[model samples]
Target: MLALSAWAAASSRAWAQAPMEPHERDLYEAARREGQVTWYSAQYSADTSEAIGRAFTERYPGVRCSVVRSTSQVAFQRLSQDQRAGVAQCDVFASSNGGHYIQLKRQNRLTQFRPVNADGMLPMLRTADPDNYFQYSSLGIYLLGHNTNMVSDAEAPKSWADVLDPKWKDKLAVGHPGFSGAIGIWALQMRSMFGPDFLRRFERNKPQVGRSSIDPVTMMTAGERAVGVAVPSASTLFAASRGNPLKLIYPTEGVVAVPAPSAIMSNAPNPNAAKLFMEFNTGPALSRITRTMFSESLRPDVPPPEGCRPLDQVTLLSPSLEDADRGVPELREQWRDIFGV
Candidate 1:
């Protein structure tokens, strides 16, 4: 055991000191001088985001990662506030909404950067932004999840429309599109698949709505809710691994695959550190960190998380860039009207 521990420590050191490409080295040197990067992130849970931050610091010793985690809309709102105040506090902006990137790019709020590691991502994810204003830094599947202690597998929701059944009234937990960017997209997709009146129908169920996509997972874990509507698969599986009574249900309507994009701010307080962080976001270190958390790995060389179905194996529903750009805001307004929150 002692020898094994030593070997593992040695391997970690070797990996940390591994050769960097010319671009990475240049950025690292400048980033070290900058000392820290502030990341406004809505891509993962707070704990997961902090873990990624710690790993990034471990990989690039002289630089520090400062993480500010919130729901997508909240994070974006904070960034907007900063912009209005003429403060360049955020270095990198990571959001679950692709539509946010579209708007930011249009406003010239994002720096045009193409990470060298971006080329290492899966081909589909690689082309997320042809203009190089943002890159897909994280991926998650949104689906139904349930507390095993409260709901049997046979009794769980098997389709997106299943949660709307009168039987699930007061027993369902869902994220609010007005707060969560991923939920905004999910709401838009649900509308596309069902109809414009989908939220009106769902509202009748009296489901508990939370601000972030991960909130439904928490409700299920506490047995406060029997089912989660449009919850993130990664956090659900990670909760299950920790002995929570959670189980994912890939709805018959197809799972919504959310690609979270991260971009450097046009007025980054630490531009070099921000660029370095962007590269790290798509690199092997982040992939390895997220894989154990049951999140999808963007890199082809990394295997799918232990409990996740590989992207290719699952039927995925994704909003087009244009659809998301137009639909998310519309859905947010509709959500506010229907949920009244």
Candidate 2:
């Protein structure tokens, strides 16, 4: 009996001694140093960021994290401003624009540090830049949603072609292209799906343009507008939770998908902590809530929210990184002319 007890104890210890996944172990080690990593993200909801920040601190115990919330463009702008001022405040950046990532890389602002799990990423996602400067989330298509107060799901349109209907004329709400990456892709898709002539034609529809892309979601939810060209699934949920009647649709011809990407700041005061932040943000800690949040998870191992369309099955109107980089400037100018806003 004594020998058996000892063996049982040894087995339990052995089982407990099994190693953590590489990234988790790295996070643990980095956290032990008690350094700070500041994150720049457009994904700011006080509740969610706080919850995530608390969870991370609990998991690591030693590390400190500060989240600087702003729009993606704001994030980029701040990074530029911080560098110009010789003040290093942000240690990580997360955005949905590939064009921004490529530009940052070209400027030698990115650090060359690949995550341990990057080898598992899709080939199309791998840019082969020496630095794993950019890591992208799993792709998710933009959705057009209707205000339930203004229209029922039955009355709601199911396809992009429905967007041009006469009833929605001048009533369509869309975000500006120069700002929102996801909405910008909507512009790209419009250009590709319908051509430049479509923009001139779409103008007759007189989309009530919002300076920020998220305005469509806000206005539609408030019932100030009947429809929005595209809104984040998560943002829709955020509004829905507040009792807004927002019904979403994935256009039949398919909607454009924007890839959200994250990067560690090259001059991050704590490189190891920055690495840990990348690892933790991409892992189960952040991924598990994707369903509830109305967005897709970045991990291939994870599945989409229930009732959401399989992104693969949806018609892909997503722009290539190269094309988006080259095309956005000209297109934004065209949009300014169309709206004169």
Candidate 3:
């Protein structure tokens, strides 16, 4: 778990609740009767997810938010199992992989409800699904990160290709694409930039592979690994803030900007609560909570996280909906074949 900092805890407590409009008030009332919202989330750390859930409960007063946090693939698998068993346990689904939304929307498994707060988000991140089945709830960059104590700035890997150098052999950490959606996308992007054999070359470095993308940062902070191949910028920066010897490196090629999205499930048992939770996700409270945790803020009113550049100022690389839908699955299999994990 990522430890919540004193600043983050204080920020969460200090956030003022915004008065709901008539439509939101009606939804909140209906959601109160349902009592709680269950969220299967893969976008943030468990602590951060729980913090957001607590913030939602505090803001609305009656409805509770139950958070089930996991890596993207694990969360999707659990949701798929629930559906297969004819269970409607998840009220809302948030995943780091955009491809999951595409697949679910095709099967008519997602509820199409546009949040009133969608207009408050950054204009570029607003549209994950044109039909409004899913909205970008979180944004993060995937880039290189190193343990500052082990590797000085001058000696650290400067670009994506730098990690492949033999000098870093057995000193690298990475996330498994088979488990992490963001890592799947990052692997796909690496393939696009380098070639099909990129992972094979990367495998030669003997990286310590972990299930979630955040794991790479964890390894670096522990000094178990000197460098992270592709790690989430938010967690890396957060670790640095906590006095961890971590530093992020935006690759010369481009940073992979991932827009983690959320949507209501069509068969949600607490349908009204799900809609209310979706609205809460795009609202100011969640934005404030995420910003304090050093993650991207979806709302325009919330500034970018401390220690990070504004999203617009960074050169970001993203997969198209079609590319991500097709590519991520393939990358997972390829990753398993190459890494044997």
Greater-TM-score candidate between 1 and 3: 3
Instruction: For candidate 1, give the lDDT of residue 245.
Output: 80
Candidate 1 lDDT for residue 328: 93
TM-score for each of the candidates: 0.95, 0.84, 0.96
Clashes of each: 0, 1, 0
Q: Residue 175 of candidate 3: its Cα lDDT?
A: 91
Candidate 3's residue-wise lDDT over 1-341, tens digit each?
24445666665666534567898899999999999999998999987899888888887788999999999999999999998899889999999999999999999999998998888888887777889999888887899999988999999988899988999999999998888999999888889989999999999999999999999999999999999977988889888988898998988888998888999999999999999888888877787788777888887787878888787778898887678999999889888898899
lDDT of 1 by residue, 246-338 (tens): 899989878998988999999998999999999989887777777767788889987777778778878999888779999899788888888
Q: Whose TM-score is higher: candidate 1's or candidate 2's?
A: 1
Residues 2-103 of candidate 2 have per-residue lDDT tens digits of 443354345334423555686678666866685677888665344445545655665666787787766566677788899899987777787656677788
List per-prediction Cα lDDT, in the order shown: 0.88, 0.69, 0.88
Those runs of model 2 whose alpha carbons end farther than 4 Å from true positions after fitting are 1-19, 31-34, 43-50, 119-131, 138-140
Which residue pairs show collisions in model 2? Answer: 170-205
lDDT of 1 at 279: 92
Candidate 1: regions farther than 4 A off: 1-14
Residue runs of model 3 more than 4 Å from their true location after superposition: 1-17
